[model samples]
Target chain A: MNGAEKIRVENLTKFFINGKTAVSALENVNLTVNDGEFLCVVGPSGCGKTTMLRILAGLEKPTSGRVHINAKAAGVPSTAVVFQGDSIFPWMRVVENVEYGLKLRGVPLKERRAVAMEHLKKMGLERFAYLYPYQLSGGMKQRVNVARAFACDPEILLMDEPFGALDEQNRLLLQQELLRIWEENCKTTVFITHSIDEALLLGDKILVMTAQPGKVKALLDVKIPRPRDIILIKSSPVFIELYKEIWDLLKEEVLKARNIK
Target chain B: MNTTEERLSQNRASLGKEFWLKTFSFLSPLFLLFLWEALAALKLVDVRLFSSPSRIFKTLIPLVLSGELIYHTLISTMRIALGFLAGAIPGVALGLSMGLFPSVRALLMPLVAVTFPIPKLAIMPLILIVFGLGESSKIFTIAIGVFYLVLINTMAGVLNIDPIYIDVAKSFKASRIQFYTTVAFPGALPMIFAGLKLGMGTALLLIVAAELSAAKAGVGWMIWRAYDMFDIERMFCSLIVLAFLGFVFSYLLDFLEKIVIPWKKR
Candidate 1:
């Protein structure tokens, strides 16, 4: 059933023009995100992970090639994004920020409020619903970003390092919460992260991307069983072997990303 | 991430310091007034030319009771209201459109750049000739003065809004009107308020300049008449009233800003 393709990126290439020179960000990238599958992308910094997500979100047009998003659920919007930092409107209260997509969709106030409140509750932020984004901690603010994505209930959830700026503890905590929330009802999610552990913990398949002039280097499925966790997975041999294999694949790329001899 | 409760505690921690700050601000003006009175009482200064604070107040009560001051103040206030509204409405509208649409900005920017620095006061004679030195002329002058200030700030506010917010708006597929109304308007509000405050100040300034030259009835005209007759006390009294008006207008705008953008921390 998961064989059905949700998104297909064929020969995707993106170039940014800088002072009469075209700098390639993504070079002939091609990938597919299966329906209701959680695909995490791990890459070196400036690898055009964000650019790819933006293209997938339909916020940017591909310089070349094609991106096909099968919006199977008609009348339902296709994509919503969780940006890296401070994406929620500072002027809006927590609930308002969460309900923003619905508000744009012209959903009635009471109905959207109920949906936003429910998502906020899932993030343990129901108590902070009336507060402004300025009043939320970095960790809590990222949670608000997650809650908004969930509340929007788009067919595709595109996250660009939503927890990238958070401290270690908050990162693990939110990852656990995210896994729990997602496990309740699985949806097609594309999450970009810098951490291999994070990619393994959340994703069914991991796509490893190369350095600048980014291209798909490797794609591997996580064989580790579900109900896995940040700490619990550490003890599992399958998790350790998968972790070592990925680290080996990623270490060379990480060095190559820095142009290390 | 300062919550309301945390903010309250922080305020309490600095409560004594805040009190002293307010007290000092309040007392500094009174101290100056007292010193001026002392200089006048001792004949250390020319009372006839300078006029003591007491003499200014003495003249103020009669001006108020005789309805002369009230009538003039009302006229000036009315002109300010009319002109400020005229400028602010279109200024904000155009400013938002310009910031959101590059084409509108490109077309209007050259015109604004050329005309903005010519000095509205320099054009006052032309305005008077065109509008015939009536209320229309005074109101028109104030409007032009206010229009430029509000337009620039409001445009800057929209322009300064983080690009991320705009991208978020697009990802969600926000409608064109929604993009402007919900995203642009609220996002640019802080800058818009800055424009409004500056515009209000300009309105106050231009009202006086316009009324002094043209109007028969405003506080500025009253000051002009007092200056002509060498009634220094009446002039002092009118000046004090004008200062008071300025203070009131600034506080009113601050209050409105707080109400509109409550999410912003002080």
Candidate 2:
């Protein structure tokens, strides 16, 4: 918790214009993420968690206010995002996908290949290095996506429910895999998810957001110890209490969103 | 163990079916040839008007032996290759520019829309006048036809690429050249191949039309000359040669597609 401030979002707001109507996706979102912290934002389906992550990733500009990354130097990218769906390039094999970031950074082929192979190995994807994305299962493809993000070695990792599309079993497996990788890399991560248990399992601190014109509803620091087993954490009393508290905050937003729909 | 055996037997059965399918496909064409021969032998069709496959082959063999067939084929092939290159290269370049830059699209899209639907053959007279009654005219006719086909398809290919891929590339901070080579070009390849396949067909069709209208030598010219002399067998030979060339060109494109876009196959 004593780590230096790695990212700051101040009075950040986003408005999407459709014809004459403007839809507020996020409103006055303000937060600070410490270096190497794994922060999860949990909210209802339309709570603009993705828009927040996109702003952090620099894919979307805030209508007002600013996001500041404490970059070590100028002209260096400080963030990478793992999108919600299958964002792995189907035309590329596993190795190529992992090497894409390094290649863009003008890394030599030999060096990039070694780095990519190392990440693929860590993801247990060494054997499928030459295989195309379409040949893999949803779980395996998500693994590739994670490997690609981590291999980039960005200053911060912005993940928008990377495992949201998978079935429950695959989602749990990837969540564990993600935790293991994050534990090793310790990158400043802002992960957005709909699952309360997932937010509790992986995040150092959890931020729950309100529905539609989303605003931060609650921010709770998860006191769960490090090197935690996700399954074991689920059965713990403290885990259940935090889950219940976050669920209670989120349930109201979910209902409000549903009523609007 | 039972499931494994079942799967093995299923594989064998499919293999057997595939073998029979291949045999039937080969036999079907041979059967048509035999039927044609039978009809011609029994004089069921007038030999003068409808030459038998055998008489066509007899005329084809002598022409091929005398190198006349090769000469015409080479001339036609050269025109097609040169014209396809001239049109396809510029077409892809312009298409990429149009797809990438809104200004280019706005400027040229109207011109493309107007001319693309006008059949290339209809403008043969204009092309002939502009390039003169020679190889230039023939090549120009084919090039113009191929250009439109390639340009339209390439533009669509670039436009149709999933914007998500572009976002990924942008996130990686890929340079413009890298964006095209690694993302846009490869991403648009399947569609581009579709365009190239279409362009190849148009090239063959336009070349034949061009040769028919104005050319000293080509399969089309030979066919035209044979018709004028009332040589049915020679005309049939030329038609058969043209058919073979079309098949070869299409097959070559398929082979190239397989090579360039290997990721398409599982």
Candidate 3:
């Protein structure tokens, strides 16, 4: 772990519905996200990947063990979340939504609007600053979500399938845009995705989790060089090997979940 | 982009229709006024019983200028405003608490369901006996009528809130107060406004009913006085004031809703 560990999860366990019909969501899951690392969590459905992300975000309490931020306590640090559903406040305009956390922290209008406009410009949404969430497309809304999270200048960003709802073309475009933003910001990020392709595209280190009682089955470090392009990365031999390994790990869980003969 | 452009054009046409609809809405009332004047001019009906618009306006101008209209309207407005606040605040608070907590809901739901059907104004005679035939009795009657409607709306609003929003707020680690103020309160605004608008109308209607029963100074009092003396022209003037007053109060509430909830804008 050395000096790289930004977040250290030590034997984190979470169980749902109490002891009555206790189903363990995460069992003694241990992981570390290094500083400036874009980590992706990929796993099958019902694998408790979201549960893990929620625990890290301090949205859910772990039944046992601990989650630490830089070896400090972990209970909702100045971390921002980009939920799958955009989570942009419907009532606020694009700029207002982007400035919400800043406003909550008592940033004045002149300063917050400037900061919000800066972020919106980066997200390519500067034109629609006055538009409401409902007025924007699925792709544009996600851009606002990204811009909002980053505008807070949070210690870490936790995104839970932010592009999962978009069409393939929008999703791909957004994935590239996210990579560009992540490269520029270089904030410690924990992105959750079900797609192996997405995990490969964004993550420096991918934590492949298993189903039922979810546990980090493997941590596959992507060997691809920086400034990676999606098209080129897909053609690379390293991408294929890592993708295959993660696919096999996921295949077992898929079969087990379906009770396949 | 193509889909949105199509939708934008469709919405533009609908907006054009909305403008025409608004124009027609204003014009329909004027058309009705013209019809009424025409009937009276042609001597189609007893002009004394149902006075013409011009006759009513002529009578209203003097009453309004002499400060009688302002005095009566002010008195009625003040009473209704006081009663509305007294009833609505507590009613919404109680309704919200009941709607949010099941234990409270279980205990009070039966009580509310039972008593809701009973006419609130029917207790006016009882209220008159208890509070006396003064401003207290009239205000109490108005408050009670408003309370029933406001309380029900408050409860329904809270009940009908999408649970997804609560879950979203919770998942964001929002504090209890933050959750209530940011999520629940705003979430319930549309419905609460619905109730408030209804309650305002109810309170205004009940004020007239209360004053008609017994009062010395109010629009309703003027109404009752005019009816008793068979002062047709003055009575028509009073009725016009009542209609205008109702319109103004409701329009004020609508204006407030627009400012507070600009999100509801299409």
Candidate 4:
């Protein structure tokens, strides 16, 4: 592990126990995420990438092995996750949703509201700060979710296919929006997605995982320059090459997952 | 231009039809009332059995002016309010705990299932024996009825909350109090309100049953008294008041639901 490592996973494994059956979700997954790194993990469905993210977020416990975060000397490092579905509280307004983390931490109401509003503005959602989550479109709700993760100002962000439910237009729009916010904040992030193009577009390094009982297949460095445009980045030669490379690795896993000829 | 004009006329005709349909819907009850009045005036039916609407109103007006109607209405309302609070508060608390804690659920669920199906009125004799044929018995009967309805509904509400919301709360590192107050409670609120509405209706039903069995006061007792005396008009008056009470209680709950859960509006 490098001195700059923010997160280190050592042979992490998880098995879901149901009645008399134990299903392996992940197997011997070892990885390190450097400080302020944007690491995207791409894989076929049932690859346990979400399970890995959940473990990192402390929402789930690995059946074996361990994950260590390089916490500051003061306390444990704070981490926030953006889940795949609409995880925003329907009862809370957009601003309240964004400020949820700070509120839970016992930050005073006024200060938290200010921080929430600031993040909302960054997402260009200042106008919708008072609106309820139900009033917003799916894309807007996801924006609120992203803004909330950013507002918490955690040491790391774990996003599990946050925009996976959106349309192609919304998916691209949010990808760009996420990049803009990430560029500004640059927190250590582990984003899990099934989209190879998305993995290349956002990740500093893309970790591809194998089919069921997921293990790291490859970690390819994205070498794409910063201040990337979502539309223009796709046309670049290196971007196509990276996409093809990841796709080539991912196709076998997809077929293997589906048991297709 | 001609087609546009034709479409406008068609829209206007449909609008006119809709207006009359709504107006007719409103007038339907009046039509029934007038028919009853006509039948009584023409001596086409037995006046003692099917009292005219005017006669019922006349009896009601006197009862109101003499404060008899108001007194009985207040008594019934007070019993319901007290009994509903007694039942609903504990029911919701227990239900929430039952939904959240496995041990509590294990302890209470079987009891709830066994007791919920038995009509509350069936246990009136037991309640009467325990509390005597007094105010306590009447109130207790209503409370028990409301309790089961609210408890089951509340438990279902809590259980029905999407697990994802709980996961989100956990990920955010919400404390126990915050988890319940901010996530679990609010997530279960719509269902809780649903439970409360059902419980309120049950409270209304059970109150009348309890009152009819033993009470000297209340609209239900008045109806029974009028029946014994063969004062059909007075009985109709009491029935009208009971209907009004049910309407007001349901309307109050609907109004409270709107205020408490503004997000449910649209």
Candidate 5:
């Protein structure tokens, strides 16, 4: 189950046209995620982590390099991206936001509502299903966003610092909710984050990346057991060991990001 | 408890604030009418030329009872409604496409920019000549004015939508029809309502201008006819009715806006 590769990226390079200069965002980046595995990526600021995810989500085109998602079967969506900040449509109710992908896929209205309501329940947002995004708090809005991604039930979930903007308590609650959902329904997920602790907590394997013109630095197997106790796991020796290893791999890139080294 | 006392006091404060607001609103018009009545009673202004609030009220009653006021008001109202719908529907369609697709914008923007600024009143003579001095001509002129206001505003509304919404729709693989129905239409609704209000205002303005120039029966024509017969009080009566109509139309639009955009700030 673990070794079956669900996604493969080979020498992924991406460039942006910045007026006169062809600015490179990602340089010869290569990575893979096995089926039902959680891969967390840590990188410095402006490191094109989002660009890589956008490419994976097919929202962007790479300058060169191939990205292949091994779709297990026809009719299952290849990817559904959980964007960084508040991405829920303000005009839509919470249920509508969660049902957006299903609606786009032309699912029947009744089925869409049922599926969305189930996902909202998972996020502890069933009570607010009929409310608009504007009526919700920042943390609640992010949960709606996550619920929408989960409702899509795509082949792979591509999250780009989904909890980066949340306060600590809300972040932990959401991480715990995410773990429960993933445990119930195993999904191939590639999550990007700035926090080493988040990477240590959620990832089956951690992908440490470089600064600008992002390149893969290291890919370390987490070996942390299932059902991670998000709070208590911090005190565990193995979790602390993995945390130091990731920080060491990420520290030089952080310095390079600030141009201090 | 102190909490209950605080809540009670808060409610009382809000109620007191509302009471003062209503009182001030009531007093402003009454104060203006009193000042005008004083000026006229003291004979500072010619009574024949400057009709006082009392004189206008006297004029208003007979015209209203005779059904002349209601007839002209309804005629003008019907024209505004027709012209507004005719212009706004197509304006929304074109504006929506122009906002969503750059090609449509490129093809039509030059035409819009050039024609939008040319005064609608200036084009009245042309419209009258082309459509013939009929109800259609007046309606046509009014529609032209409303079209530009709604189209430009609706287009801006669509363009101003946060790009994150667009990205969200795209990531979900929304079809073209879905994008328009869900993303573009609902997202731009606030601006569309703004455009509709502006369009309605222009509709009112253009209809009066059209009627004054060429009509035999509407409030604008009534004002013109009163001026011809030297019926000073009657002219004032028509002006008051026109002001009321404008207020009613604006108020109706405000009420509609609240219903449509429920997610807006309270």
Candidate 6:
């Protein structure tokens, strides 16, 4: 399991019909992420970055080609997704929402609660154990969202711009928190973000993607060491180089995305 | 513009408003009862036609001690419970199926439209003719009356469940049973309970009308028998029993709603 290729997408294409006209969303997109690797996918808005993430999570289907996990079909999933919004069930309290997957799996109540509480503690949300999603702050809700995916102990975690909605300070804090958890868990994770600094700060490899009819434009591997600190990494030359290179690759796509094409 | 102490005092006043609102609600009925009693004592109103609270209370003790009130109340309750079970369970199941499948809706809509407008109680005479003047006829009429109300509410509830929730459940590979039980049932419960509460009231009314035709038991029968004997006090006592039963029914449903949907609780 340690050396296995966690996910493989081969020649994937997606088409959308807006009224009577058809538009290609992604074309001939192929990629693979190895086990325990943290890959960040960056692309212009509507570039199918989120679509690709949804595909990996089994929330959407490609118009053509195949997605495979460990040489098996990926139409269903052995993955869990942390959506862009908090997406916590308002009807469920913090601990109950976190334990949802476990509940579905028929994990016994006492044990499931213990495991849910453990994840909540990791997310610094034990104090809000019994609080409903509506009662939590935006940052706290996202924390619960992340904790929910992790609590399920999924082999592959798909995150679609999980911090895109947060304020800068909170985003940075959560980014560091994400890095800390990812380092400890070492699960295969594919994260979607528009933030170059975020990709640099957290990703072992960054996938830069182009706008509409999305294709992998560039893949940059970060040679940074593990247990990286946010303050230290921001100050490092290596981090700055990777950030600039990715930004340089992304600038044109960003322009095209904003309709300066 | 106000100081902290003034703000605190204002907050206290607002809290007092909610407390007073509840107090007013509880006291309003008692006040109405007091006024009625006063009017009767002063001979401002005919006491025989509009029985005062004291007279009604005096009438209630003997009816209870004689065990006649309890017997009538039990018979009425049993009929309602049986009728509700007969109607609502199948009605909801059928409604949900229709709601989820467009084809079912298309096929069933014509029949439902044709029959839904027809007052179910209007068929009571036909039911009585076929089933005879027994408990079965009354129960059957009550069931038919309640069924359509539950069906429409359940169908609407199922159709109106937040689509995003269904999408979420599907994305997680929820089994069909899981989808219905977790998503459909709980999502539709508030509406289903809404239907049931209305159905209970309708069933009670229909029970009285059914009893008026010819029946020997139930609160409705008791009321009609007392009317025939010109026992106004007994009639008032039966009406009081009916009111109490309706109150209890509504309160029980509300309590269950709060328990099941604790999300509504503060």
Error of 5 at B236 (Å): 2.4
Residue clash pairs of candidate 4: none
**Cα shift from native, residue A186, model 3 (Å):** 3.4
Q: Give me the iRMSD of candidate 3, please.
A: 2.7
Error of 5 at A240 (Å): 2.0
User: Compared to the true structure, candidate 4 yields what TM-score?
Assistant: 0.96
Candidate 1, residues A21-132, lDDT tens digits: the string is 9988999999998888899999888889999999999888899999999998776789989999989999999999999999999899999999999999999999999999
Write down the TM-score for model 1: 0.95
lDDT of 2 at B95: 88
Model 5, A4-100: lDDT tens digits are: 9899999999999999999889999988899999999889989999999999989899999999989987776888989999789988899999999
Q: Native-contact recovery for every candidate? A: 0.83, 0.56, 0.19, 0.69, 0.64, 0.19
Better of 3 and 4 by TM-score: 4
Candidate 4 per-residue lDDT over residues A46-126, each given as its tens digit: 999999999999989999999999866443237999998999999999999999998888889999999999999988899
lDDT of 6 at B197: 84
Whichever of 1 and 6 has more DockQ, that candidate is: 1
Over 4 Å off, model 6: A1-5, A71-77, A90-96, A102-117, A126-138, A166-170, A222-224, A235-261, B1-23, B37-61, B96-114, B155-160, B163-171, B223-235, B263-266
Model 1, position B113, has a per-residue lDDT of: 89
Q: Where's the lowest-lDDT run of ten residues in candidate 6 chain B?
A: B164-173
What lDDT score goes with residue B227 in model 2?
83
Assess each model's interface with DockQ, reporting 2 decimals per model: 0.83, 0.69, 0.26, 0.69, 0.77, 0.31
Candidate 1 whole-model C-alpha lDDT, 0 to 1: 0.90
Q: Scored by Cα lDDT, where does model 4 land?
A: 0.90
Can you write out model 6's per-residue Cα lDDT over A160-245, one digit (the tens) per residue? 89999999899988998888888997988999998888888888899999988799999889888989998898989998888888
lDDT for B72 in candidate 2 is 94
Provide the lowest-lDDT 10-residue window in model 4 chain A.
A70-79
**Candidate 3 lDDT over residue span B94-147, tens digit each:** 888887778999999999899888887787889889989788888888888888
What are the per-candidate TM-scores when only chain A is compared? 0.97, 0.97, 0.94, 0.96, 0.97, 0.95
Docking class of 3: acceptable
